[model samples]
Target: MTERDFDEIAALALKHTGIVLGRHKANMVYGRIARRLRQTGYRNFADYLEYLKDNFRDESTNFINLITTNLTSFYRESHHFDFLRDTVIPELKKKSDKKVRIWSSGCSIGQEAYTIAFTLAEAHMASAFDVKILATDLDSNVVSTGAEGVYPADSLMSVPDDAVEKFFEKNRTGNQVRVKKSIRDLVHFKRLNLLEGWPMKGKFDVIFCRNVVIYFNRETQKTLFNRYADYLPVGGYLIIGHSESLNGLTDRFKSLGNTIYQKIY
Candidate 1:
């Protein structure tokens, strides 16, 4: 693909999703989107670009899905779940009205959300408080998969053994597992673009965004973190990816280490 063609596609992605595609991704973009060209009967990137202008309203959805990376696994960042179980949820129950809210902002396929729910269940908060976990992702496809709550059996490797035994049922082949009703009932999945406005009404006790902002520009990161702070009350928790830190990004949260932060002000 030519630089001009790559630039146009990148610009569209950034404008619509707030995700920046560096020049280095040009080859990767071409490789992934080439199938769309074949399906649409376009012979080249230039033709595809021209075609997308008129059809982007519909095609952009698919394009965004193809471009946005959805790399997640059950408790991929195990420490965050440990903190939730060991510390956060207990503290939240101590202060709240016997109801707690947690958001998995870039929830991807719901592992994090389910993990959070299972952690709370293990903590026995279900005995006292009603817990709600909202799992959201920009890609609707993954959102639907998360809602379905079925995954490859191997996906449970990182899940604590007790959780797997309690929360999932193996399918006939035992090659797939589906989340049980009790755990599934705790989470609600929705399609949300972080760059856009959020529709959630109540503030959350904890927000797990994790690894989502690495694709966004610094300015967008600042704006998004500020927005996250707005959704959290004083002392509410925010857990981002291990590689991410809020040090110079925003003063909205103070570091609790291990990429965890607390809304201090």
Candidate 2:
């Protein structure tokens, strides 16, 4: 790929998905875009890019899916689940409305949302409250996968034995498992871009946007954090990836440490 081609691809990614792609990402971008070229019958980066610009309305979703990263697993960051079980759920239990909403923003392939469902079930919240988990991603492919709620058996490796037994049902081949209906019923999956408008109307009690903002530039991160704060009320929780922090970004939340923040002002 030419330097100009990479630059154009990077620019499209940033504009559509808010993901920053520096010069170092050229090799990775080349491989991904090359796959698109093969599928679209283009022979070169220049040709594909020109076609992309002309057919953007029809092709943007494929382009976004090709470039955005979706790396996630069930309970990948276990500590966040620990806090949800130990603190968040308990506090939420006291609310008179008995309704709760948790968003797994940037949720990849549904593991994080399922994990949240598992935690809530373990706490008996599903039986006691009106609970729902919204799982969203920029990639339609992953969003569909998440909606299907079926995964390889090994995806449960990090989950506790009892919880796994309770939440998932293995297939006849025993290599895959489907999230039980009881749990699947508590979550909804949709495709969303953080850079675009949100259709959700109510405030969320907890928002888990873990490991998603690291791919964005500082300005984008600042905007997203503020948007998250807007979606949450005072004392509502914002849980981010372990590698991300709110320091010097915004003051609407106070650090609860371990990458957990609560809206205070």
Candidate 3:
């Protein structure tokens, strides 16, 4: 691909997905876009770029799905869930009505959302509380797969044996597992581009946007956190990846242990 072709694809991605492609990322862009070219039956990269520009809506959606990286697992960063179970949930239960709302932003393939639901159900709060988890992802493919709630057995390796036996059914046909209906019903997955204005309504008691902002530029991170602050109530929890920090971003949150932040409004 020519330099101009890479620049155009990167610009289109940044415009639609808010993902910035640095100078060294040209090869990455080529590898991803090349697949899209073959899928669309385009002759070359230049033809694919032109098609994307002409057929903005459909191609843009496909491009977003192709370029977005979705790497997630059940109970990733286990400590955050532990903190939620031991600290946040107990406190919320004491002061509030038995209703809880959580937004799992950038929840790739639904593992994190399911993990949240499993934790709540294990805590025996499923029937007592009005629990709902909203999971969103930029990639349509991952969002649909997550909604299906099927996985390979390897994906359940980290899940406790009891929980796995209780919540997932093993598929004999091919090393597959399906999340039980009880757990699947608790989450709602949607396609959300974090760069655009949020369309969700109501504030959440907790928001899990872990590991997403690390791919964005610092300015994007600041804006994303500000938006998270806007959507959370005072003392609501914001759980980020362990490798991430808000140190240079904003002061609206006070650090809680285990990579969790409490909105201090």
Top-TM-score structure, candidate number: 2
Query: What overall lDDT goes with each candidate model?
Result: 0.89, 0.93, 0.88
TM-score of each: 0.96, 0.98, 0.96
Q: State the local distance difference test value for candidate 1.
A: 0.89
Assess candidate 3 and give its lDDT.
0.88
Q: Which stretches of candidate 3 lie over 4 Å from their true place?
A: none
Q: Roughly what TM-score does model 3 have, to 2 decimal places?
A: 0.96
Count of backbone collisions within predicted model 2 = 0
Clashing pairs in 3: none
Give the winner by lDDT: 1 or 2. Answer: 2
Give per-model CA RMSD: 1.2, 0.8, 1.3
Please, what are the lDDT tens digits per residue for candidate 1 over residues 115-166?
8888888888766788889999999889999999999999998887888899
What is the full ranking by TM-score, best candidate first? 2, 1, 3
